[model samples]
Target: MARGEELYITVPSMFRCPISLDVMKSPVSLSTGVTYDRSSIQQWLDSGHDTCPATNQPLLSKDYVPNLTLHRLINTWSHSSAASSSMHPLPPEITSGEIRQLVSGISRRPDAAGVDELEKIVRFASYCEENRRFIANLHDSIEVILRILIRDNERVEFLESAVRLLDLILLENGVRERIQRLIFKSDHEKCFDSFLSILKNGKLSSKVQSTRILELIASTNDSRQRTIGEKIEATLPVLVHLMRTETDKHLMEAILSCLISLSTSRSIKVQLVHLKLVPILSRILSDPETASPTAERAIKTLHLLSTVAEGRTAIAEDSGCAVAVLDKLMKVQRKAKEEGVALLWSMCCGHGDARVRERVGKENGVTKMLVVMQSEGDDRIVRRMCGDLVKVLRGIAMAESSSSYGQGGLGSLETKTTHIKPY
Candidate 1:
């Protein structure tokens, strides 16, 4: 249409992907079901601009991220180059057969018990960012070193170096998960005690490094493998200390969830109550937005706490604990009905106190819980538990109804009505 139109060169089909050049790797799926290299194609599709480049037809299905080794290779190379400028780089890959090489390569002379070997081992652990085969080996190496550091007979000074190295290892996000998964069957207290010492260092910056420590400590799977006594005796104080000192949400979640899981311990239950964590938990329940998904983790932790005898005693001591957990049940009714229904169902644990029932019922918690209970027509467990919760609620309502009758029957009946009429 314009004088310059003929000057525009046509793009060649060879430039397109030979497999499907119309769109360059929308998902880039491999035969192994791994999808890779998204953005360029995904954004093109998301922009509502999909059409076959060669045929001019609408785009079809898109693919998911794939599990191909080449994809991992590409991602690894890209991140490695980018991470060169950082203090810590790529995280270690979880590998199976490299444990022996990792162990031997990092071993010190039998007499090298000084902090010098500790320093070299720590540095090797941190280089996991480079993520070569060495990266995997380094992770395995950390386990062996951790054993040496956590051994009760080891000099405490080298244990201190393990703390610093642990922080560097967690600089990568997935490292926390890897550590959480790996620390399951180890002498965790030694590691935790080491971390606590680092935390207590007066010279350490409380802002950034504290949060990383909290995350790893929180996600560590110590509970999954350790005895309940071991978990409380070894881990709770350290995590409690983290909760008391750290303010970042990720860290708070890790500490809180860990604490919640450990609430079975009479000691930690006493400590949380002694520290007045109930009001804090209550405030979080009232406003899940402070932590978003972390808030959800907190709520689940609270639910777990509610199941323990020590937890119950703690709740009894702090009225706010029951109030907070039930408050979520109330919120589920008014603001998030779907989630609320689930809470009520779970909370119908065959029993609750009068004060809790009253507070929750006054907050309109009963109506939602009743609806869920009424719908479980054939669930015997639900039926038994719901009946108990309903009894509690009805008793509260009857007590109110009788008091109202004493005050003024008809008018009170109108005001306290619980029935809903359908239009």
Candidate 2:
């Protein structure tokens, strides 16, 4: 067997860490008689949990001892298993020297040569987890790449390559925080402007990469999310434009995810409404073949948009938008159903527009599905909202019944006394 090459064997249950669920490299036993990977348990303890994760028993002592016997058993078993099989040698790890060479190459040559360097970095990072960790931890690795992006903001090919590399490596530990710190602390405007430039001018793949990066950054925390929303406010129009013009499912999904993350801000929500996001999302949702995740995101964006007056008006004003929202109620996914309920509630109740309520009431099986959703699921808010929606639909039914009676010259008493069941 090659030196230091791990055997790709199925781990025994006892060999797995309870916290991370991975094969433990350094097993330790706690006071509760539960064994865990030392790093996992230490991290859990560092995060301020005083109880054992597996048993939830109060930890009388925070200290742990190395599971020397268990560790020896695992190591012996691994070696024995390796001896019985023809083991394939793992790929060579990418080195900091190689990354430094690429960074220097990109700096010295910023044309096809630079793009070639970035392609190399991207290929290396994309190879495996070890390579990604190596590149991500190497000092100034991400910063150098971001600098290439900023310096060559006008070079489309280089920009695409750099953005692609960033997207690939940003998932590594501390890479996102490193980039976040670099962007916000130094060259904030230039970094974001480069992203904006990509959104506005780069090709479809590059735009997708940029949008994915935005989505990742937005997911870090609320403050950073709001900051990104404000910084990329200009790109909101660009994103909406892309959604309107592009038909690629991946690009569409990425843009929708970024928008949904940024839509938490009221100003951003209003800007999106003004940019006609409602109709765009409505059109996406109206399609039958739209992927479930995409449809759910579209519904969620619309649900957020419905929180504001302008958004509600925009959705209610669109002829097919309200129908699209109702369509999601019948979907099998609970999230879609939840967003659909919240959206319909926001429009019907927030606007108090009788026309919107009447339209929801008129849709087939909506009430039945809403009732089913309430009874089957444990989401109390949805149940309560469903109850309110049912009342509105019933009221709409009664109003229509009363109108029909009056038109037929039936007695006023019948019109006044009639009751309509939603089911």
- On TM-score, the candidate that comes out on top is 2
What local lDDT does model 2 show for residue 346? 75
Candidate 1 residue 374 Cα shift, in angstroms, is: 6.9
What's each prediction's TM-score? 0.53, 0.68
Q: Give the per-residue lDDT digits (tens) of candidate 2, residues 390-422.
A: 667766555564666553432443353244222
The window of 10 residues in a row where model 1 has the poorest summed lDDT is: 18-27
lDDT of 1 by residue, 4-98 (tens): 33322332332233222321222354233324334333323332333432233434544445434544443444355333323222343434234
Candidate 1: which stretches are off by over 4 Å? 1-106, 110-140, 151-189, 199-234, 260-277, 307-310, 330-352, 371-380, 395-423
Backbone clashes in model 2, listed as residue pairs = none
Stretches of model 2 off by over 4 angstroms after superposition: 1-96, 104-113, 220-230, 398-423
